[model samples]
Target chain A: MKKLINRQPGRVGQWALGLLPFVLLIIAYLIASDARLAANANDKLLPALNSFADAIQRMAFEPSKRSGDYLLWVDTLASLQRLAMGVGISALMALAVGIANGTIPYIRATLSPLVTGLSLVPPMAMLPVLFIIFGLGELAKVMLIIIGITPFLIRDLQQRALEIPREQIIKMQTLGANSWQIITRLVWPQLMPRLIGAVRLSLGPAWLFLIAAEAIAATEGLGYRIFLVRRYLAMDVILPYVVWITLLAFAIDFMLSRYSRWRYPWFHQQGH
Target chain B: MAIIEMKNLWKEYGDQVVLERLNARVEEGEFVTVVGASGCGKTTFLKLLLGTEQPSRGEMLLDGAPLPAEPDESRGIVFQRYSVLSHLTALQNVMLGGELQNSRWLGHCVGKTRKALQKEARAMLDSVGLGQAMDKYPHELSGGMQQRLALAQALIKKPRILLLDEPFGALDPGIRADMHQLVLSLWKSQKLTVFMITHDINEGFYLGTRLWVFDKPRLDPQAPGAYGARITYDLPVGNCEKNTLTRINRSVGNTSRAINDTL
Candidate 1:
């Protein structure tokens, strides 16, 4: 919560600041729309504002739900499932492959140049090639995302693993811990914070790719629905679809970052 | 066996030599304290004995064999810092060394092995006067308590040789003296061969059966910084009051004064 102001005048000033932008926009709109609406006040704004408020309220209530009719839509179970499975599996694979690259010096040396070379190859250019290999499928979508995401995961986690305290390494060595024990007990546990951040960042790109993936060849999902609307120029459907995607993205980030905080409470002990 | 011996040891970094042509020995079940002023290679010298660092020009023998790649069950080290795994309880930290000696396969075969390790760890903690602190993390404990935990962690394996690197440097004065007494008692009770580093002259003078000083031997004749990093004091440990003890103190004082005035 915000620190509430003490004095009534001071409180009013702060609240006025909060309302300023919306107030200014409304005032401008009312002045313009008033002339258009002189015959009837409800003709200018009430229906649109009421519908907008309803959409927002619907979103606020069942945040975990993706639902229908309102502009704030992730508004369906199927769309949420596709996102959860797609992003969840891809991010997890990225973490595993990336951690391996970062931890094993030899593997990193072997894989990095190839990855760097491949990264330069445009992802869209591979779409035709992937269609032949994967046969118009989910495999192509998930794989495309995995490729897009693994490098970031590998780089961030590698950096995090590298930054583990030197003293701890020495202590583990003195404790007679073998290399595997050190990585499993020390390195992986420390990777939780950076891993969560990596997952958060990758979620945005994953969603972007999901829409692209679904836009290509899907049937039932949000992207497919948006594509159907695009054929008819139904801005209502397309705009609401985008609004819901953004809402879902915000929810995804909030939940994972919350989990990151819970799992690694000592993360704030760092300089940040 | 002398347990540890350094023969004509030469440790160097590039063109600068740290410990040059130095011969040292440590007997089984004895306490030796090495002390020196700043930059005296006191730490590097101990690292060689601890098997953390290798002597560039010579070899060290432990228990009649060449030094192992890792310091073995026969030797344990207490570093200058707590070096206790912060995530582990004090008891867990103490139990860590002994646990390392147990094979994971064996533990898997036998159920409830942690309870056994916990019991042994508790015994070691009791000896270090930290039995009550067994459940706390190193960060939750004071520096003195942490060192005591480190001491237990080091000695729990019942290693024949114990190496401590300025273990009391971070403790308050009162804690330092109390820890010093604890170290003395533990050494006497266990009949443990101990090697320690100390900056406090009184500490070195009191704890060591014999004291060695480290000074950089490469200090330039005309320049200030080129002096040897450490100088050894191969004298016996004693207090100030007795006749023999007083004589030894005067000799140590004179030698220290002479080194101060000269190099």
Candidate 2:
């Protein structure tokens, strides 16, 4: 007999084990929803499953009467666009600043302390300031996400670059590599996979900052739509939106990890 | 001519002395193997030869001139680990030194230049017995194979001096024997001046034309770093009688054995 710590399920059993919690949660939700509907029939807090289906159909399939656009797709597109812009700019900045800070002593001395200080700042606290300056436009929302995650990404990449073995650097130097060659040929390629990993970790916080910004002031976005329906206690609409956002986040993370594995097989080998 | 000459070289870091009063003259095509107890500055000596560390208090002349402050293509180094880049295939790793030298900005060459470099790199890999594994990444290759790739990478530059800091220390006994043969052949054919550091006295004697032993003659109990290691014995290989081996082994004592046991 195996000890509890040593025991692990086989493939079939593992699949069943993984699904058990989700199945239990679904059953619990169904039962809770049935009881709430039986008692009040007008409970918005725990809407019946059919109400959620109806909300999804309305938000995703039907065009709005006033706007004549499918609300869900429009909201998703707007949110994704802002998220892409903020994160893209952050990635480029982190790569340059992080590699410079990691590889060059002068740049590291000049910028490392500043980056550390910026990371220590609470990005949420800057939201009001950002809004006042950038005027509640898309820039403010994007800036919040950038301000929230770029410092962290830069620090992560800097540490990753520093973690490159000292021997490798010496070996390259002995091979007649100049400073620029070492950075472009060695450090840059090495940090790309790490950058992807860092971005994956930052995605959760990036989403949080993005949603917060949108919730405060936006015409249409997942967060804005969710907050707008809160006065009506529209749990069906809110729940569906929340689930959709989560699915999107999961899909993005999955794809990024897959891409990293595909592109940098060597990095994944070290992980294993 | 003496390709490298160290006149009373010393290396110290802050209050701590690492090596002191070291003097040696290594000629071209000479294989010098260094053996010492841990913290005896064998690696520091190798770094000095590789041009990564400048002598703190003495002069190191290369080819009748002062050694460069930084490492360059005239010398190449291979460590026990991280000698090969993980991102590059075995072929690309060999070509990297050449590619960087040819192209100033991009560190890559294209078309005819690329083809010529590729052919040269393939030949270098073949010389190191990694011809079939040219496409493999460093992680995919075995430890011995990876070291072979590392050797190929260093040799591609046609460096006059090769500094190996226990390049085969991590390998198994069988693999180490194979590497020894490969290295001896490379040294003879390339006419390279080799400086290798090893813990095994037998390896030092077997592989080197000249064997250097570093030890500290003075020590203070209160301050461990008070005295630094010096080249206590510089013996020519093939002429060191049995008694000399016993004397060195006895003096090196449990420290060398401890290092070997851990390995």
Candidate 3:
């Protein structure tokens, strides 16, 4: 008979185990904050839990004195808008370029190496160039995100599209699908879930680029807020903002995962 | 009149000849099964017929017209593996042919048309003995079931010519026999001009109205490229008595096994 209480822990225990590190991290931060405060009453590197709560309450609930807008909400909205624009544009562009690269031999032969070379170049190094050309406006910031991640995403999607079996393509042709029909009907539908998966994998680098761009030059954004508070050593504000960014990223990743699983159950079943 | 006519078909990749001086004719409603050693250009022949590959030197005619430059709706094929899309349900896979035929780019059927297509697809799945598994994905189905889905997908298009490239090579013995019966019944009912390739000698003899044996006629140690596979034996099994068929089967089986060993 199967034991109800075996040596192994159940689902709840497993979740607790998974979250144990985070709990330990918060506890360690609290302890460090207390020790630092005891040693130096003015220590700003690590702030107390109440200080974070107060900072969050102010940024989240209260309007800024100068702008009269909830700063955290405003920053989140702006950052998400930019991230969405950048990632959305990149996903579309990657689908087009990746499909071409995977399907058209001539296009693949010409563009694959170029894409590889472009991916190798550090996107941060082009920041000055982008700013010079597009100015220090939203375009430059969004373009920075695009340039940072599009090539990698394109390569990822191209590899995935290419991995589609030759037999399927031939079979599609035999099924009376023209070149256009084959691409739009057969390849596109199949690649969409994989594209979503690629975008999910790319969210980390995307956030990195978004934050770097916002940190360098931005009037309002979570990254800009964090960096701006850094001058005053406002760990209280910066840490919460960082936590907020982490939460947003997690939420986006979770939503995308659920969407793909729900919308493309067959893709999920393929063990991808 | 022949449904498919190939005259002196020679296929070569630079100096390496894969097939040479192959001439054959397949009439409508004939079940032509090709048996050959590995690397004997059985697949290349099918590819040529499907118009996926061009022969080096030959004329291939379908219904007395020159074959099309590319695969079209007139010919349908089921490969040994990766025959069904992993991202589509069995019904969706079957409906894909009609959907593509009806719609243009991004051809997603909707409303009454979609309902009609779904109905047709469900009927196709039922015909393939997969009515209960219409919603199941390819990975969720067994090997035989997946191949059945592939058959439904191929047959849904209702092509005049059906190509099967070792379609049952991967199934278990019992399932393979069932599939053979299913495919034969479908062919007879549909009057499909079937071209199949198989490694199994018994299957090749049992299923086909006509049999083709492809093998290199000569061996050259110094210049292997000088020789390529040809139709060494062409036998009509349509009117053969049972004893004669058994004798022919034994001889052909031995001949193919010998060729396979040599190759």
Native contact fraction, candidates in order: 0.19, 0.81, 0.84
Task: For residue A34, give model 3's deviation from the true position in Å.
Answer: 2.6
Residue-by-residue lDDT tens digits, candidate 3, A51-82: 88999999999999999999999999999999
Q: Candidate 2 chain A, which ten residues in sequence have the lowest lDDT sum? A: A263-272
Candidate chain B TM-scores, in order: 0.84, 0.94, 0.91
Candidate 3: segments with Cα more than 4 A from true spot: A1-13, B111-116, B220-226, B238-263
Q: Sort candidate 3 into its docking category.
A: medium
TM-score per candidate: 0.76, 0.97, 0.91
lDDT of 2 by residue, B3-57 (tens): 9998888999998898999888989999999998887789888877777788889
Say which candidate scores most in DockQ: 2
Candidate 2 stretches with Cα past 4 Å from truth are B221-223, B254-263
Models, CA RMSD each: 6.4, 2.1, 3.5
Worst 10 residues of 3 chain A by lDDT: A1-10
User: Residues A1-272, candidate 2, lDDT per residue (tens digit)?
Assistant: 88999988999999999999999999999999899889999988888889999999999999999899999999999999999999999999999999999999999999999999999999999999999999989999999999999999999999999999998898888788889999989999999999999999999999999999999999999999999999899999999999999999999999999999999998899863
lDDT value for model 1: 0.69
In model 3 chain B, the worst 10-residue window by lDDT is B251-260
- Model 2 TM-score? 0.97
Steric clash pairs (candidate 2):
none
Each candidate structure's count of clashing pairs: 25, 0, 0
